[model samples]
Target chain A: MSRLDDALREALRREEPPEGFAGRVMARIEARKERAGAWDGLMAAWRGPRLRWAGALAGAVLLIGTAAYQETQRAEGEQAKRQVMLALRITGAKLDLARARIQRVGYGLGDR
Target chain B: MRIAIVVLAATLGTAWAQDIKMPPAFDKLAAKAEESVDVTLDSGMLQLGGKFLSDKDADEAKAKKLIGGLKGIYVRSFEFAKEGEYSAADVDALRSQLQPPVWSRVVGVTSKKGGEITEVYFKTSNGAQIGGLVVIDAEPKELTVVSISGAISPEDLADLGGQFGIPKVELPKSKGKEAK
Candidate 1:
């Protein structure tokens, strides 16, 4: 542990680069940056004009689909309500007719 | 999903042990008719409709009350392009479904003016309460059949009259008097 500490302190001491050492180090850094693969280079590329528009279109489609789906459900509910009303209307009309007949029968039976 | 919930409620809440299924023979008539309306609202549909019915709306309230104890409502109506598109055999087939001891035709009105015939049948359980009713309105160019299965009565039906496009009913004098 003492040896490691001594090495770290020695390395940490103020140091000056040899004659063109700074230039060499910078050149190495530039070369390493160039070696970064095409995938990484493409990833860092500027977003194209159509990319944002495509994202917006996809978002719009998703929104419309959600709205349409909900609208369809609502429409179905409304249609169900309409059918119920129609069914009741028919029922009421028919029942009224039958009731009228029964009434006539009743009056006849009573007079008899 | 919402429909599923109502359907489930119908299965549990309504007293109907079984929903009256429409006969397959009726399918053949659908293709021949110019316009057909086939509505089958089981206990679930009724119960679901009952939920949206407002006491403030007289027709809805009346319909709601009328269907409260109902198990199902089935209506099959067809309008043909011409007369005699259907025959008595078809009528007899439907009438046969109403066999004896259960359904009795309380009224059959034949109108010469419109060449229309309307037959009404009722299923009586006790002496007073009617359990179900069927209506068949046959016109020269149209046919309408309605079946209501549930615990019902003439008075219960009378309750729906005077509104909802149902003409003012002239209830029987003696019995109507007692009913009120």
Candidate 2:
């Protein structure tokens, strides 16, 4: 292997990210939770009902909107696909015409 | 009656708006191949664009017959099955190809929804634009490229719609075994 290939292989061989990576990540998450504290937890509980209701309503709206949008997109995509196909057909026809012209040119040259 | 008229008007408007348009033709000769690549070449740094392949392929003769009139080939593609399947380093490899005196950066547009990055480049010949390139790093579900070459007109590109052998509009009653 070339130097670049060797280097790439070496890099690939060292698959492990780093030592204590998971521990460090967990510790950071725990620290954040501690800083958030009991008051934060209490507030979350108090707002839980309202938040659930709001989330449900938002989800319903989002689902409906997404369905409508997806339908429109599907229709548009179909239309565009059709257009592209048509374009290719037309282009193909033009190529046939050009080939005929070239053949005519060849024939003319032969006659000379 | 008023509602019906309003609906009809809206439908007509939409149809008009969606009408396929073509660009103006110049003295330049752009061949019509079975597969077309619309490339915008500025300089040595090439930015590959778009490709249209013919649906039918029987043999080399047929393929050549279909592609004989084509002028250029353009391809914008990406390979990714899952999230984070590709990394910055992979993109950097592509970017590295466009580095320095050959190509200069113009714009980089990243879309979080599709997890794609489109970087546009200008080919420099003594700091002049002789070509253009766009690299799109996209997920399997979302990838697209638009390439043009040889004095291409935007209008022609738009009109290119419906010229290829795309399926035709069929009514529900006519839908038979072919529908599947």
Best by lDDT: 1
- TM-score, B chain, candidate 2? 0.35
Candidate 1's residue-wise lDDT over B29-119, tens digit each? 8899999999888888777667767789877777778888788889998899999888877877778666445667776776677677778
**Candidate 2: segments with Cα more than 4 A from true spot:** A1-112, B1-76, B79-81, B112-114, B126-129, B140-180
Per-residue lDDT over B1-180 for candidate 2, one digit per residue giving the tens place of the 0 to 100 score:
999999978865553333111122200112212223332222111211112223353322232232333233344333334444334554464465555444555445455664545444434433222333323323333332332222223233223322344332221232121211
Model 1 CA lDDT for position B153: 61
Q: Per-prediction DockQ, in order?
A: 0.20, 0.03
TM-scores of all candidate predictions against the true structure? 0.60, 0.26
Estimate the Cα RMSD of every predicted model relative to the unseen true structure.
10.7, 32.3
Interface RMSD of 2: 18.3
lDDT of 2 by residue, A1-112 (tens): 6999999898889577699999999999999888788769878886898789889989999999999998776665444333333334434333332222323323211121
Q: By summed lDDT, which 10 consecutive residues of candidate 2 chain B come out lowest?
A: B20-29
Number of the top-ranking candidate, with DockQ as the measure? 1
Which docking band does candidate 1 fall into? incorrect
* CAPRI class assigned to model 2: incorrect
